[model samples]
Target: MALKQIWEETNMKIIVKDLSPVLLQTKNVFEVADQKLFRYGHLVLPCLSQNYGPTYFCKLEKIN
Candidate 1:
């Protein structure tokens, strides 16, 4: 909200250096922001994630 207030109509991006699938699969994990992104954005997994061990790096492109 604060960010949007400062920079309206700008593209927003979230960079996750380390995201574990295991953590996301947990029953207690529910992030509102992540949920919104998953619902309104397209998930993109790069080839580098395949070789980077258990964690992954991904991007989300908004649906507009």
Candidate 2:
């Protein structure tokens, strides 16, 4: 199923972390996560990239 459909049906929340101020301010972090989730069924919690720095946390949850 498409990511949007899956998202709507499951009502899953995408959790993002370790985003820099620029990314947060520009909402690029969410764009990255959304693209990743759409292209791939899942994404690595903490991306191993210098841009994102270092962080070890991630969570995907369904709305109750």
Candidate 3:
């Protein structure tokens, strides 16, 4: 959740998959955790998370 907090500090909306199963199951929306990220994108962070493992960041609509 620390990474998510950092993103929020910078005004970015990130979906840290696994944390939300319903969101992951959503069709044609976005692919998160376990699945390989971006066929056209690159790794953003090479660090570890305290709550989530080997963190995978997903961009999603912001929630207010």
| Candidate that would win on lDDT | 3
Where is model 2 more than 4 Å wrong at Cα? Answer: 15-64
Best by TM-score: 3
- lDDT of each structure? 0.38, 0.43, 0.44
Q: Model 1, which residues run further than 4 Å from truth?
A: 9-25, 28-64
For model 3, residues 31-53, the per-residue Cα lDDT tens digits are 34333545322233333442323
- Model 1 pairs in collision: none
TM-scores of the models, in the order given: 0.19, 0.19, 0.21
Q: Which pairs clash in model 2?
A: none
Clashes of each: 0, 0, 0
Off by over 4 Å in 3: 1-5, 19-64
Least well predicted 10-residue stretch by lDDT in candidate 2: 35-44
Which tens-of-lDDT digit does each residue in 1-64 have in candidate 2? 3446767786566533333344456454533344343433323244456355333223344445
Pick by TM-score: 1 or 3, better one? 3
Candidate 3 displacement at residue 41 in angstroms: 20
